[model samples]
Target: MGHTLSSLYPVHRRAPVYRPKAFVVDDLATLHADIRSGGLATLVSVTGSGLVATHLPLLLRESDGPFGTLLGHISLANTQWKETDSGIEALAIFTGPETYVTPNWYAAKQETGRVVPTWNYAAIHAWGRPVFFQDADRLRDLVTQLTDKFEAGFPAPWRVADAPENYIESQLKAIVGFEMRITRIEGKRKFNQNRSAEDRQGVIRGLRELGAQGDTRKTEVADLMENIESEPPAGY
Candidate 1:
């Protein structure tokens, strides 16, 4: 056996997220909030063939673990569930609003022409070992939970019982449910947090102007940036 530098000084693994000090979100509660607000998640898994990913909405159960449990279902026709390697951890990426930030929005641009365009956004990445199931009863419960969540704002919410029993049971037989046991979680909110107040104000103005012109995406970014002003981030 050969002993190399690794033997003398072991190296720890770096976090999967490319988060800067100013962008990392550390609060568990905040992370959960962001995940729920994001609505849909991109679930990724390492399989024997390679990597596979699926886009779906997941229900976040905070009482499950320190981080939380993610409930979602996939069609049996989709091979991802069968291919997933239990030994490997999975990732659920929840992305919030994102948009381009023109250098014109930076106050420094006018002074030194030193600013360049960039992107501003928020996202949460959760790591966990996914547990897949095919029980019809559990699948029915999962469907009902997801249904009630999305329909809550309506005057009258539709539910699983609204469908015919035979049809509902047949539908359940076509899908498999899964729950992710969250082992580690991370979140990032990058909305001009590293910029100066003047620069940030300029961004807010530009974004709001765009929003007034019918680009609601810009408005979302602007709203988050404005929030930073009201509640200053505890920067690293």
Candidate 2:
């Protein structure tokens, strides 16, 4: 399934004030891939008292539709699910590589003393209507899928069936399953896209040097920026 920029949430952040349109990623595939790669997301909701947030590993069912559904479970002991009102809009935020960018890294700072520190990062926001379920069968399937996904990279993957049937059932009862039908998605990649080529190169070099010294995140961000600078939009 494919999505258009029209399906994205309206921009109401400081991004429009400083980050140029070039940094706004309208590509749905990129957003989906980012969500998949960055499995953990922050699910936030508003309750009567105030707001709540939970961090969980979410599964994106791409086959579901253009804006795929998000699947995850919450501990029954954690009452967020109970507090969550069905049909209410919720936001799921998935983040990618992020690092502190020093103003000294920009060539413009040297040429015109007109640079400030900023953060370089990538992120996606997914808005959806949440639905909670307690069906044992559905919960079983969801747990199985989550287990399979997380364990796939292991040399010896563990299966849910490996556990005793009664034990698994008891464990399943401790959690509740949820599915959020995604309605709108927005992605932002702040990789100095608004800066000149020389400034970008300087930033990339500084990041790589910082990464080589010890900062792993800077290394990853540098690589992402390099790739974005080299590849065409369609290629990404």
Point to the candidate with the largest lDDT: 1
Top candidate when judged by TM-score against the true structure: 1
**For residues 1-236, what per-residue lDDT tens digits would candidate 1 score against the true structure?**
77533343233332579988888888898888878776878998877567899999999999998888999999999999998877667889999989998999899998998898999988888988789999999999999999999998899999889999999999999999999989999888888778888999999999999999999999988888777678745632
Per-candidate TM vs. native?
0.92, 0.87
User: Which clashing pairs does model 1 show?
Assistant: none
Per-residue CA lDDT of candidate 2, range 64-174, in tens?
867899999989987788776443567888989998889898999989999999989898888886788899999999999999989999999999999999999999999
Worst 10 residues of 2 by lDDT: 9-18
- In terms of lDDT, model 2 sits at 0.83
Off by over 4 Å in 2: 1-19, 233-236
Error of 1 at 88 (Å): 0.6
